[model samples]
Structure formats: structure tokens, C-alpha cells
Target: MGIGQGSATCGSRTTCGSLDVKLRLFSSIRKYYLFSKDTAQVAFFVRYMSSQGPKEELLGLLPLSGQTRGEDIANAVQKCLEDNKIDLNKIVSIATDGARSMTGKNKGATTILQSKINHEILTFHCIIHQEALCAQTFPAEIVEVMNLVIKIVNRILSKALYHR
Candidate 1:
């Protein structure tokens, strides 16, 4: 998404323009043969203002091996930023799903990342995550109907003519 103007001052040694990064993490279990493996994936999207105007783009998708602790998540993000040659001081804010590993006060990814930066960065829980949590409170009957509708839609979309 296009972010606001890049007026934030850079605290690092470099004088590059400021940027705002949004981070989202997804964890799942995949079955390979008879064994199941836990996998974690992270997606980073950055917004910055260029000469023309505001711009946003996907930085990269990183797959984490083994356990996805607060430290692991933070390191993955740090590596991505470094690989892209983006300075840590340019980060104006970070948005996460509010998971314990991401939001934990002492060792959360955001907390750790903030410490690495010279200036304070804004942190907030994603609204989509909040909506998903609220959806869980929906009545069973309503949820069932929604699921049935999704199935019907999927079946229709699966057909070539219907999809077209």
C-alpha cells in the first residue's frame, strides 16, 4: 500500500530516505508422506516515497526452518532488510498479527527490532487479524452457512466455463 510522505528523520549513519515496512507471518503444518512438518513463512512489504510520489512493493518471501521463535522471526526480517540494503533506521513502523512471538513485550520480534533501531518505531496489530479473531465468535449456524456458500462458489469456479 502507498504510505504517507517520507518526512521521518533517519537515525542511522546513512542518509537514505525513510521507509515503512509491514510484516506478516503465517505458520502451517504440511504432511510429507507419513510425517508432518511445521513450517513458517514471512512476507515483507515496504512503502516509501520516491521522486514521483508514494510507492509500495513486496520485498520478499522468506521461509524459516525449524522452530519460529521471536528471535528467529526477527533475524529473518533483519536479514531481508540487509540483503535489500535498506537501513534499519528508515523503518517508521511495523505491523504484525499480534502473535505472542511477534508482540511479546520482552522478546517479541517487533520489540527486538525496535531495540536494533536508533529511533522509536510505531507497532500495531493488523486489522485483518482482529477481524479473523472476531469471526471465530460468529454463531455456528452462520459459520456453517458461510462455509457452504464458499464450497458452492469454489465448485462453480472450478468449472472452466463457469470460471470464464
Candidate 2:
């Protein structure tokens, strides 16, 4: 991995490879993906920067036979990390859907991982969920316009001439 000697803006000018610089670089090195659990599986993906820019890889997935509470999810995550020989300290950001079990104030997976890692891990709610919420708020006029457009497109596409 190319470790570019990055700089950090502190109260005073720091030299290259300083603690601040190393911390900043380390934090930006990789992203942790904390996916939601709907069934009985818990999984996470790893997104890292490379010569080709950001690429995501599936770390691992573990099945849970019991309850899917925050504690259970946290344990499964821990096992996945251990099985994959991944260090928790490298996790910079955790991305998950906004479920109570995933984002609960006291016992969510994010909170549990933060506590175990003892780092101020950044948390991000899934953008798809946010977009869905925003979609629900679209004005009636805009929805009607979109419906009309969809109908027109469907009608056109259904025609034999357009099928070609």
C-alpha cells in the first residue's frame, strides 16, 4: 500500500509522518461496512483505497441461530473480524441502515463496536434509506407528473413499433 506522507492541520505546523499525519492517514486508509441483518446473517464489507481508487470487498458473513439483537449482532461481527484476522483499529467508518438494533444509542452494533475498539468510530446511515425517506416526502404534484411520465413511457414501450 502506498502510504503517502500526508499532513494534518494542527495548532502548530507538524512534520511529515507525525502522529497527527499518521492518524489522519490511517483513518482515511480503509472504510468499514456494517450491513444490516434482516434474516439470520450478519456481514460486513471492506472498502479501501487503491491505485484504482475505492473498491469494496466482502470481508465475511456469519450466521446467527438465535435472536438478532444488538448483542448478538455485535458478537457475530466480532467473530467475523477474528476469523478474517482483521484489526478493529483499522475501521474508520461503519455504514449501516438506520435500524434500532444497528443504531440504538446504548446497545446498537455501532455503539458496541465503538466500545470494543475504544475509538471514535464514525457512523453513517445508509443513503438508500435516506433517499427512501425523501421519496416519501415528494409533493403530490411532482408525484402526479412522475406517474404521467411513467404511464406515457409504458404505453410507448408496450407498442410493437417501439419494441424494435
Candidate 3:
């Protein structure tokens, strides 16, 4: 699903159940067409569990200039929050990959954001990232097999040769 439009509470309890409800923020940096040049931009997203299961929305993309320090990520997130008018308090947690620029001890994006939002917002490394890390522990043979299978599947799908 998608995030509700307009100014609505992000993690409101749905009628489905009284289970834990939270708004999750996810982000990533990627190359995008800007000014006809390939540039790295950080794209932010918001996610939450709803009655229909889960929902997410693309917050915004910030141009990454020079080194992407901790403060840079914090500023990008703050600008996104301001532009979208999303209440900082409503953000129950932030999920990001375990990058030094994100979860560093002294100066990190999450730390900087906590200072700006004035709350110890719950944070964690992305589950997918954790799983990938775990996968690295598998034997090289298994990893190679998985990679080969992935490549074959990707090629088949890209060529529209896969039926069903």
C-alpha cells in the first residue's frame, strides 16, 4: 500500500488489531538523472504497518555533494521532514543499513537526527542487510550457486523468456 495523503497520523491504529504500530523510515543513495548528469542522491522513504498490511512512500531525494558525512544525511532527512510536513514525533523508528555514516558512535546520521528531533528514536540496521551479512558466512560453493541462479533468473526475466 501507500502512505496516506495530506496531514494524517502516520501510525494510527487500524481496526484490524491492536498490535504494535510504528512508522519506519528507510533510505538509500542511487544515481539519478539530474541536469543530464549522473549524480548520487539519497532517497528517503516512510513505511508503516496498516490494516491492509504495510505501506510505504517515497519522501524525497537529496543531492549528495562531496563526502556524504553524518550531518549531510541528517540535513537531508530534516529537509525531507520539513518539505513533507511529517511530524518528527510520529516517526517511531528509523531503519538503515549498518554504514559507518549511519550508525557511527560519535557522529552518525541516526545520532544527528536524534539530536535534532530531541528524542531517542529507535533505530536498527535493515533486516535485509543483516540477512545478507549472514549469507556471507555460508560456504563459497553455496554462495556461488546462489549467485549463478540469480544471474540466470535475472537474464530470463530481463529477456521476457520466463513464462509463469
List the global CA lDDT of all models: 0.82, 0.81, 0.78
lDDT of 2 by residue, 58-123 (tens): 877778767878888888888887877878787888888788998998999889988988578889
What is candidate 1's lDDT per residue for 1-164, written digit by digit as tens?
66444545334313332222111111122322355456778888888999999998889887787878888898999999999899988999999999999989999999999999999999989999998999899999999998999999998888848433
Order the candidate numbers by lDDT, best to worst: 1, 2, 3
Please report the candidate that would top lDDT against the real structure: 1
Tell how far residue 151 is off in model 1, in angstroms: 10
* lDDT tens readout by residue for model 3, 34-123: 355566577788897889999998878788777788888888888778877877767778898889898887799988888767566899
Tell me the alpha-carbon RMSD of every candidate. 12.9, 15.4, 11.6
Clashes of each: 0, 0, 0
lDDT of 1: 0.82
Q: Which clashing pairs does model 3 show?
A: none
- Residue 134's lDDT in candidate 2: 86
Q: Compute the lDDT for candidate 2.
A: 0.81
RMSD after Cα superposition, model 2 = 15.4
List TM-scores for all candidates, in order. Answer: 0.61, 0.62, 0.63
Q: State residue 108's C-alpha deviation in candidate 1, in Å.
A: 0.6
